[model samples]
Target chain A: MKNTYTDSGAKDTRSGFGAGLLELGRRNDRVVALCADLTGSLKMDGFKKAFPERFFQVGIAEANMMGIAAGLTIGGFIPFTGTFANFSTGRVYDQIRQSIAYSHKNVKICASHAGLTLGEDGATHQILEDIGLMRMLPGMVVINPCDYNQTKAATLAIAEHYGPVYLRFGRPKWPNFTPEDQTFEIGKAITLVEGKDVSIFATGHMVWMALQAQKLLADRGIEAEIINIHTIKPIDREAILNSVAKTGCAVTAEEHNRYGGLGDAVAQVILTAHPVPQEYVAVNDSFGESGKPEELLAKYGLTPENIAAAAVRVMERKKH
Target chain B: MSITKDIKELEAWLPQVRRDIVRMVHAVQSGHPGGSLGCTEFFVALFQYIMDHDPKKFTMDGRDQDIFFLSNGHITPVYYSVLARSGFFPIEELRTFRRINSRLQGHPATHEGLPGIRVATGSLGQGLSVALGAALAKKLNGDLHTVFTLQGDGELQEGQIWEAAMFAAHHKVDNILVTIDRNNRQIDGDVSDVMDLGDLKAKFEAFGWLVAECENGNNLIEIADALLLAKSLTRNEKPVVLIMHTEMGHGVDFMMGSHEWHGIAPNDEQLQRALEQNPETLGDY
Candidate 1:
């Protein structure tokens, strides 16, 4: 059979986010960017330089930043708030909930350095529960794109889409596996390959690992279907059920806690429709320590080998 | 009473606003009457003399005319009465206060698409930020019209107010006027006993705001003068804050002096007695 997957190279998703923001600035005058003392870290220097009048530097106050974004929406401005995942979610969750989500303000909360691979920053900086915190809010859209190209596409898409959205991406460079020219559609899962024995559902930094796991599973005579779920809230239910219906078993992989992250989100859907044997390729109940990005990924059980092993375990459980 | 208007003309409407407060509260049987009564003259002077607004064409983005936001939304009786009496809507709608499908919600909201409200602001400390944003938008659009906001003195305890205060001062947001109803009453008790806001006028001045005080917030002439001072202060220098002193339940007898009447509605007998004190001058809702 022909090789169905290809890695274009490796690139951090934050670059894609920056490029998308710059493009958005060029296209629309109503689009404004706000950052909480992380303009350089968020790769927002281009946007700031180009549209200094439209950019608002909120210093280190994430709470004030969120409220300002919500207020900016009243003037018909599409505001994108950028910060680290921890500050964006846990630190200012109430602000987002009240001012943006509950009030239904059209604000884009774009978070960088999500998950354990944020590396060297340790567990304090790495926010694994951001997706769950955002997803729980009513009328809030949660999106976690896989690679550089996908993250860029999603950033541009969310800028165009109205209402509140939480776009999450990471700091570590990953395999640029996704096609560069692909358009992003919110709440739609992309099926990368087809198989019958097991289905691999993954998101964000873990999608590339799931693809590698699919290859490993094929070598071991276990056919694994790969589904890239970029949007976690308003999740693509039809695609997940159809994949699980065909594959008979499933494994969810993500670089987050297994408690309330993508694993829990996918597991809820599976149990509701087409209940089957499944395995979660995610971090257990343990905080991460300071390490290199690659070391952290392996230490947290978010590697391709871990996914492949979970696939084998799930496939064996499918027999019962 | 200090206004230049003929006494006959002014006296005819003052009691009507007070009556509207009592009737609107009695109709819902559960709306705030104290602050509404306290803020009556300010709203009366605003809708009556100051703002060149048309009730018939209440636009959300009132480009040509000025805009007003009530941060202390529990005083909806006065606001609703002023809007209705000003011709924003029919006077009959006042009877539907807090009822199912009523435009007048317990807290003011933009979700109902009310013509007068620009944004929902029942949750305290958000209106100043929003008003500042509106002021900023007006500046960006090159519109010279200003934004006005009224927040409760007790509402100052919220942290978001300080955030907005700092932001407005830092940005030199001068096209907005924020007033605090310094009635010294809150849900718990007197503001001083509950949480002393030590020298609020000095505090705003220290925060780089042009501070103005109204000795009688219930007097139309004093309010108009305070508003003029606010206008003269509005340049590119700083924002203006009016520390308004008024009785919690200014016109009503039983509701005054104590914080117990801050948010409660009076019974039929109490309403009758209150209406007798301030006789229906224009007409009751």
Candidate 2:
């Protein structure tokens, strides 16, 4: 109905993970932290410094770190493992699949510096396929919070959740648009702006871009309904169906590849329930190169302009 | 938790366990028997004497108790036999090995509700890290009990083992005791030929682990003594790994030291030959 979501300030989501982890350590003694030699990069130094004995520096061994995290659950401790998203999921998929996902271990896989936003590190460090990889695993709860406050909320949220959880966040200071004190509900879509002309479903860093696109579209007289789909797996099917039914067309946006990310998740949900014309604003099937975060986002067509353009294209394809 | 110096009990127990290994694999006709037979004595020693676990109440969370993890899960036949005979499940269930809906998965799995298996293992080089995590959790919860994991000598080829090795040393997760089933044979051929693991003892020592070796891994007495020694070395600011030397398929005259038998189940005539060598003592499952 109204665009009420506003930017509180620019804060990196990785900091939220660190702050939430520190709080969790103080709140619960069973909360343990493990890192594969990138504690500072992932913003896990707070937890590590607070709980030294409880913290384990896994020393560049992500696969082993994952296994040890899975094992820690057997002794009744909730272990949050920290590393870049590239190493977190793709580097150690088999270990995560066998030791954690298959056994249903209560392990939190905290991945920072996800997507093209990682910047400068190039294609090797950026992990665009993590959402697809994690969501494909059976019984894994995948959450990619948009802003600092939501990331912190999601961090604290996953600790309370049992079984395997993949919490994806990123570096770089972006628009902190979500409510500061809002509780993060996994698998429930958060509607930031509501309009009838188009349904804009976005996740991760792209959520801010969608909000920006909502404004530009509003000026052009095309009201866009922007919904943030944080939890990708166990996707909010009802929310997607209802929003698309009203709008009659949809645009899915993400910092991930269009092949198997938010676009695919929404397509599966809407295609099954309310098949509608849908356009995607995401990374095409290709690798990214070293560049600034803003440049990479623009070069990869992951910006507000691209989102708005996709909305227009999808609306044109709508059945009259 | 102390291994009775009664070499007679383990000696009497070995033939039956060996029989179970071959019989289980032969029944499936599609499981690894070489490593299983090679590590028979080690499994018998761990389940019967090493770990402080109750089979009657097999829980995934083996709290305040010594737990064993088979990192090299291809050797499931021996693990199943040892777990069953140790009372983890009905020994008769061994008859259902690798069958439809059987808890005895081709590899160890937790989803089947199998007891004594805290984590599903078979994908190599993960067990050590999982055992370390369990050990760390025990420390957080103040669990004085220890954790044990077995890795195949061949399985050490997976890069994760080295990673886990580094983590164990740096973090001082001393509550875990990792035993390497040093049967120098993998699926392809000799481990040296497939991927040369140059001086494993030296490698572990360099990784900051308290390393030891059993002169003969398949020897019950040697395995029992080395395991007890490894147990005593825990809580010493370092993890312990026992590199026990074993043949690929020990005891079976035709299979010993041969990688060809690594995953092959004996034919009917070969099964008869294998059974004839070891006298059945504890009775068949």
Candidate 3:
């Protein structure tokens, strides 16, 4: 649960996606890539350099890129499309809905600069609602890995999975705490700590914060159960139900809007099985602005302290 | 072998297609008949002789076979009829046209598990991009088969169509052929007065596509020649665009040249009158 390795360095999940995509290019000839004018930002330069013929520069047109990706599926090519989270969702939702999601194409939509942590390009660029938007579409797999290693594994896994997948990652460097060799599994949650007082469910960059909060809660004699839910849709209902049944309370945290995202996805699972007191640590119906990633997390109430506070509040709400 | 035999065969089957259109539209009480009747000859030519396609082993990766996409999906009645007549599905399923649980929807969709449809396309201006995408995919996969698509002239007004046009040309997507249904009519009005797609052929050429013109889409000989020319124009590098001039209501004299009947389903009386114009080509479905 702790960042025990002192030499551990932080790396952006987008870099992980780029690295994974490069590996895929080397291994699979059918793994073609498309970028909506953000090759360097999405860390797709490695793939582009290695397989120049397979890489398509789609300019700034995300809609066209999505349709093209759908078309590529017909010819049995697995296409990985990269862009900012905002453009990946908002600018091309209809195209994705009709061409990719509806057609059930094997297209990997790799999104970067997710949540308020994207920092500085303001509310327009920092997309906190991408998970909500993508998860709403039926037959679309949604994944938000916690760290670099998990993200790379997810990028590789989604390429092999034969269907539409939205892989959401971020721009900032998070604490690289997950084991480097762990394989990514869809619809499964990774339990980081065991507790009985309350369950703290989180995903994406928020998983790192939830881990920090676990330490803080432990110091306060609060044994908080922490589960990292990388896959948002096809949520780990079994893990959530089991954890909440033991803890009798839960605190959900994510670097996303409170209405939808990991917190909402977790709450739905908990609500259907065992009704329990739940507190959410997420953006409270407000758009993000230009700031440092850590600062934005703090401002948006998604920091470790905020999650710890939410856990305490939920634990208090738990009646014997 | 002879034009007389071809016309006799067409003349025999054209009425059945017409009756199928009317009966299907009447049975469902929904669907665009004008365009279906309008584009019959073109559809007949493609299915009967021109296209090297088979419904049995439908694959999105048409490596060895030609592919066709319906960009203007409102003409589903025609597409569904031709597809059924050509053996993509049991012609009996035609009775369920636009019915719930039927593969035949108001617009063509792949969701119904329709064999020949690769992508679900009801919204205009999207199929062209998908076709271009498929075409590009074919080239990347070393596929020798060509891709084909038909779009309504009014559909050209969509910004996505222009985007696709630019994309196909910029990428030199030469393994695909695109045909514009230059029927000059849309749901709202005549294409020219509605939104004037001025000089579409020139615009396509400007976009760097090899261009062809079909004077009469209903003329089997002309359509066959145009498709052949378009095929020859496809050089595995530059996409082919053909401006197919078609009457919105070709066989049905009462429905031609006016936007009023563009999407209006013919009533029982109108349907009967329309049927009298063309003799039963193939047996009535």
* Model 1 CA deviation exceeding 4 Å by range: A1-6, A285-289, B1-3, B6-14, B59-64
Model 3: CA > 4 A from native:
A1-7, B1-8
User: Over the full model, what C-alpha lDDT does candidate 3 score relative to the true structure?
Assistant: 0.85
Candidate 1: lDDT of B268?
94
Tens-digit lDDT track of model 1 for A198-298: 98999998998898888888898888889999999889999989999998888999888888888888889989987998899988977787999899988
Candidate 1: global Cα-lDDT?
0.85
Worst 10 residues of 1 chain A by lDDT: A1-10
Listed models, DockQ each: 0.36, 0.86, 0.72
Error of 2 at A274 (Å): 1.5
Model 2 lDDT per residue over B79-127, tens place: 9988888888999999999999999999999998988899999888899
Clashing pairs in 3: B12-B281, B12-B282, B13-B281, B13-B282, B14-B281, B15-B281, B174-B238
User: lDDT by residue for model 2 over A1-320, one digit each (tens)?
Assistant: 67766788899999999999998999888889989889998888888887898888888788888999999899888999999999999999999999999989999999999999999999999989999999999999999999999999999888888889999999999889877788989899988888999999999889999999999899999999999999998899989999999999999999998888999999998888889999989899988889999999999999899999999999989955
Kindly give the stretch of ten consecutive residues in candidate 2 chain B with the minimal lDDT sum. Answer: B1-10
What TM-score applies to chain A of candidate 1? Answer: 0.98
Candidate 2 residue A64 C-alpha distance from true site, Å: 1.6
Report residue B247 deviation for candidate 3 (angstroms): 1.6
